[model samples]
Target: MALQEYTEFITELFESGKTHSEIATELQRIGAQSCSLMTVRRFCSDHNLQRRNFVSDESLGCEVLSAINQTGPSYGRKFMTGYLSTLGIRAGEGRVGRILREVHQPYNILRRQGARNLNPIPYHAEYMGHKLHMDQNEKLGMFGVTHVLAVDGFSSKIVANVTMPVKNNLVIYNEVYRAAVASNGMWDQIRVDHGREFFLSLYVQEKLSQHRFNTNRLPYKQTTSSKNLRVERIWPEVNTRVNYPLKRALVDLVDTDSLDMQDNNTKYCVFNLTCQVSQIGLERAVQSWNAHRIPGRGIPNTLAAGGCPQRISMELLPSAAEAARMYEDELGASLSWASAFGTDPFSSEEDRQQAEQVFLQEYPDITVLFDRAVNNDLSLFQDALLCLINATNRFA
Candidate 1:
């Protein structure tokens, strides 16, 4: 019954023009072997059944080609696929790729090459001008001082480093820029420790660039990337090792604030120059620190006090007479002789110009800063202030 039934099923299907699948299913019910698939192909070939192939109409292709040419060289295979799909002509990727190549004229194949990575290319500490690092401590609703630390990585010099108020943007910006410009026309890269003050708006970049110096508004980051490291990683290291001496002078150190400033501002520095001291006494002050922080390589770490100086005038009315006297007291005494330095300076015209390049190394700023009025008398706090100025000026 099984063999007879299998033979009868195929004979009936073949006569009735049913496909081999129908014969196979009938045969399988009677436990037949799996040989119907090859039989179907062989029968089809023997009968010479004409296979149907799908092709777009030549007129349609001409229309499509015209539609394609109507547009510029912008459309590629992707665009063609989308356009064809809209017209109910779903084409394969291979066809589209081929059509795009021929119709698009000279087809271009894309290729890329990478270089063998060499040593890391170091980032420029300065942008158009110099590098400025800034940090501001929040007062935390107290009378405590807010620290603004601005250092120039190029020089390892503190441009405008001092403690003030959390809300003291004027003091920070005015002083920092002054230090930067007096020596090096405004800062280019201003790195900060992500503090409130150092974070500037994009408008600030435009505004600052409006000045003489051109500054690109980069987000002074604190990474060690050769492309754009904010240069903060090196700051703490310098603070402890090469510049360890300045740590004692500074207080309330913020780990991140140094980063905030480096991403923002550029400071003054004196490297590779014949240095001249602003005053002998000021030199003595920094030199004294050498006892604690002596230079192994001829005072490699000479530090300076106070910001860049500019002679600013004050007008006081005669009605309130003590204004002139008060100004003198605030600045302290004008040290007739220079202050103490942790080191000495070259006392020559050549040295003066060279030191002027880096305000820190060349001429020690008058730390006990006293802005004596042009016409004002230096009678009031002159003596005490001068002593204070001298003492601070002598820091190395």
Candidate 2:
């Protein structure tokens, strides 16, 4: 029954969700040893098990809630407060709000529905607002939901996305407002499978009336899983092409020892500041997909602003053209073949001859696409030949 042994037991208890005081009293009850609150807290910190939701009122409210729950059913804070006082538990109004929001949450208390459904198009407003399917999912490394503003999974286009906490309806509307601003105006209909925390926000009606987008919203819950989400496809491409690149640019801007640096902060800053860069990045991503990097993903690269090229390259860089030429030579066809099956995938005596004729007739002998605009090195262009792949490879 050493103090250290007692402390170890107390730490285990705390890890098991037992309070410090409970551990203290229990240790003394077992006639082992006792520790102070400060020791218990320090141990918690050392183990990286900081107390969750450390608001004073939160802990206080949980105490109050536990007391009330043992007694009877008190629907919300107001009912619980009045009921608790009958048993001599008195708390202030401000304290209730804090406790309710932070500690004893009334929202998640009840499990109403598990899965969400996508109902048939209800009698809703016409055009612009019809069946804009919405879903939420998280990204790796950053464990936060990326609220997807989508339409049909078959029609994969990112209408909007919010990469922040969705606290309530007001917060969601504010995010929706930001997304709408990015997309010109409000959408007509918002079709969701589940009733989210922000579903009740009057922002939908208020903003609709103000901007006169005259939008209406409808919710359905055919299924709970967000598997068939068209917006999810964008996340992978975006992670690879947009988000990862942006993350890298920012990392490299500060990475003094980085062997691969993109000049100064200009490249990183461009994406952060201008929607144009975002638009172009999005376009290039679609183009990459169109190149059939995946089995099927070719689609329009139309961005918000007028069609601007994301892959802005100067005259073909010498190295880029050389690489392009090497790719062409290995393929034994013009640059067109290099554009299609990469440098070399398949070669047949007859197919090679046909490819040579096709490259000469249909595609130019030496077409040029500016190289990867890397490291503020627009001065260096990677000449990639754009030969159309087999039409069968086209993805909608």
lDDT by residue (264-333, candidate 1, tens digit) is 1111111111011112211222222221221231211232222222222122111112322332355462
Per-structure clash totals for the candidates: 56, 11
Best by lDDT: 2
Q: What TM-score would you give candidate 1 relative to the actual structure?
A: 0.27
Model 1 per-residue lDDT at 150:
54
Any idea what lDDT model 2 has?
0.38
Backbone clashes, candidate 1:
56
Residue 83 shift from truth in candidate 1, angstroms: 77
> What's the C-alpha lDDT at position 192 in model 1?
54
TM-score of every model? 0.27, 0.27
Tell me how candidate 1 scores on lDDT: 0.36
Q: Encode model 2's per-residue lDDT on 269-312: one tens digit a residue.
A: 22222222233444334333322211142221222222111111
